[model samples]
Target: MKLFVFDLDFTIWNAGGTWCDSTHPPFAWKEGKLKDQENRWIYLYPEVKEILSELKAEGHMIAIASRTNAPTIAKQLLHMFEIDHFFDAREIYPGSKLTHFDRIMKELKVAKNDIVFFDDEYRNVEDIRSIGIESVLVTNGLTKDLVKPYLTRTIARDLPQSEAC
Candidate 1:
């Protein structure tokens, strides 16, 4: 019954060691690897698919919110990764993560209290948390272990921010 939001780029996948906007387009999936035109591999972090599937199987909503300048490229990568079916909503654009959440809330009709977000950027985590959404700051990558506790909860409320976290 919760809306699980995720940021692209470093949170879900790394686009050739850079943001999706910087990677050359016309990306192709070749030999089980997804790469841009320049042959730079755009890869999802390990455990991403497992956790996404786990959320979907449990009937929890899933979405993507990214500030990448290349929304089209990001979508392409998502599809190329064969994980596009996992998302219920997507707000991929260049702007504050707050804007993305606002649109997602309006579209999905979900309250901020029901949304648990994950993002690699500290600023984005702070932005979503300011609105009373529980957001996890993803540093290494997204993993099932990272989101397990939140999944078991019914309403994941906001937490007080700390410098150490």
Candidate 2:
């Protein structure tokens, strides 16, 4: 099975250039908005929920790999948004993307080649790709068009070149 892993902050939601810091406290779902202690709103980008739902409906396993320092706030936001159940595995914390992928791969018992990772950061994308996993740099966040190609290309790319012909 193909495993889809995504980064949290910029990739999943718009944290407004400032992540949840100690003073910000955990996020709360209030009046249909996700707000921190200081009432800063965080919102999911366009098509994020639909794309993730589509992936899940297609039987792809979803997971998270975030470098956010405020994991509690991240998890709370995920829960508040009601999309946390879509993920089968998660490695959310402040660390290298490689470490996150390594742990995810082990937990899921999936090979590196069977995983597709998405992150807004180029450095994270490059770092994850260096370990043999297919990685996409999501500059504009997750969208159906961006993720569709990977979903369709999964089987063909995993096949031996000679046999794929």
Q: Each candidate's lDDT (Cα)?
A: 0.87, 0.82
Query: Against the true structure, what is every candidate's RMSD?
Result: 6.5, 4.7
Candidate 2 lDDT for residue 57: 76
Largest lDDT belongs to which candidate? Answer: 1
lDDT of 2 by residue, 67-144 (tens): 888788788778878899999998888979888888888898988878898898999999988888899988876777
Off by over 4 Å in 2: 153-165
Instruction: Write down the lDDT that model 2 would get.
Output: 0.82
Worst 10 residues of 2 by lDDT: 16-25
Show pairs that collide, candidate 2.
none
Q: How far in Å is the alpha carbon of 110 misplaced in model 1? A: 1.1
Cα misplacement distance, residue 77 of candidate 1 (Å): 0.7
lDDT of 1 by residue, 83-111 (tens): 99999999988989889988999999998
